[model samples]
Target: MHEFDLIRQIDSFAADHDDVKVGIGDDAAVTSSNAYKDMISCVDTICEGIHFKRSTLHLSDIGYKALAVNLSDIAAMGGTPRYYLVSLGIPAEWDQEEILEIYRGMNDLAKRYGVILIGGDTVSAQNGLMISVTVLGEIETNRSLLRNSARVGDIVFASGTLGASRGGLDLLLSQGLTAHRTEEEKALVIVHQRPDPQVTLGELLKESGFRIALNDISDGLSSEIWELAEASNVCICLEEEKIPISADAIKLFGKQSAYEYALNGGEDFQLVGTVAKTHWPTIQSTAKEKGIRLSAIGSVEHEGDSQVFMQKNGERTRIKRTGYRHG
Candidate 1:
């Protein structure tokens, strides 16, 4: 199919929103926003070889994840996602139906979040398929959650369990796509394919009006904590036992491997950050009422060389960047 025709087909997936003055069919998207609100934007790209393998992942999974990762970024800032634009690098091997399937995947998630499709460009690629997404979000003016806002003597916390995505990736590589026979295996694979961004939890934290510092756990607990410490200029000390690992992760990968995955493995997309020590109880209660898992794993110490440490059995060990990184 021709590029213009393909774009016209993809335009069928766009959603209508009152704020949007112009949508997918234009040179650029025009949208209105509340004067008291601030806009938050983030972009993420996933390539065929670096991000996933065609043999293990479906075309729709690629589309879903490309947008999901960007949503995770907006979530870290405690913003409500509004619109998104997708730029695709199409390889010759993919057909028009496959491309449309990718858009269908993106549209499914967009509808759930009330996000609309804006404008973007599509181009031909020589190597493999690539998808890049840019997401625009809104937050109350001056209320943006930031990584640099953590203060000394603050409590560090994370939402949901960690390391299941890494375990899922391992399973996919070793067992192939159809080999997930058990419930645990299937759960792991599902997490790897479709990560749930903590948008609601982020919004709740913002609504609570607490001064907090947050970073999404895209890389790993250790790496993200290091980012938080560095950005906030504080030392973070974590209790080894407090890190939350799902029972399914432990059951499949064993206790030790599960811990390793929580620390070093990446792509969990959970939020981790610091809050005032005194405010933790109320925050915890509010999150609990909403059925969200918020775990306090550590505390911020006096300002120093921004560093992170893990305490296990009375031994404190300095942590390094051991999570996933692109070369």
Candidate 2:
């Protein structure tokens, strides 16, 4: 009914962890990760209507995504997510059951990932609900992946097919769960509603002894590739044919729109990274063994300047570093 009561109810769902020196019900959460390694921290926030439509998005999904997106940041650095703090701005209109369902979703996901919901604050909002999640993770200082470490001779790769999430959003906006859709179309809607962060794959890359540079594809493939190139001071040349487009996306949006979605659609939550030519074989082999769709889409090379370009047919076209940006 009230703010403190609601916080107490949510806090009861938090799991215990030894590394958490101080957890919920404290002034601030205190965590002690590995002393020898480095700690990675990331924060992400989503507001109703802007990030999700209440007409189609469930409260459980909103809670899951609020944490999943932050976990994606930890995964991009090849780290293990350990702890999280969730802050919410709850509107007065939402019933208590809806509020509890939010934490139920987050607690389930945190349990799956061994993450602890340490502490956070909940406040009243005049209008829509807002969720802000801060995630803390750890990784070996030397093994932590960097976006700018790509080398000229490295091969660029992307994990999983892209653009289905955007297609899903289109369906949700246009149809609102109507019966006149294919199974593939329904699956795309689920992808947009609930995204899976690539944490295990990131761990695999770190443990394989492969030298690499990495970043998760949150904004878009083209934009992320540009970040990798700019950070590593190398030019990336991608073969348009090599970029993996989801079959569902093609069926839903046709070839041209699907490719555009793959190139510029945001929130896919896949990894795009670079591996040296010498280590690409091992990485590719291991990824296949793990049943991960890791595809080589491009190459890193030195040009007059560092940039990203797509090669189609015989023409070379520059890729714009454009993607979804929060205002």
Top candidate, metric TM-score: 1
Off by over 4 Å in 2: 1-35, 177-181, 324-327
Residues 154-273, model 2: lDDT tens digits: 999999989988998888888885547779998888778777888888888988767788888778899888778866778999999999998999987998999998899878889999
Against the reference, the lDDT scores of all candidates come to 0.83, 0.81
Against the hidden reference, what TM-scores do the models get? 0.88, 0.86
Question: What RMSD does model 2 have?
Answer: 8.7
How far is 32's C-alpha from truth in model 2 (Å)? 10
- How well is each residue in 1-327 modelled by candidate 1, as lDDT tens digits? 354466567768877777654454321233555768767776778899988897667888888888888888888888899999999999978788989888887887788899899977778899999999999988877677888789999999999999899898888899888783699988888888888888889889999999989888888899889878876788999999999996788999898998988888877888998999999998989999999999999999979779899999999999985543211
Q: What is candidate 2's TM-score against the reference?
A: 0.86
Off by over 4 Å in 1: 1-35, 323-327
lDDT of 2: 0.81
Q: Number of the top candidate by lDDT?
A: 1
Clashing pairs for predicted structure model 2, backbone only: 148-231, 148-232
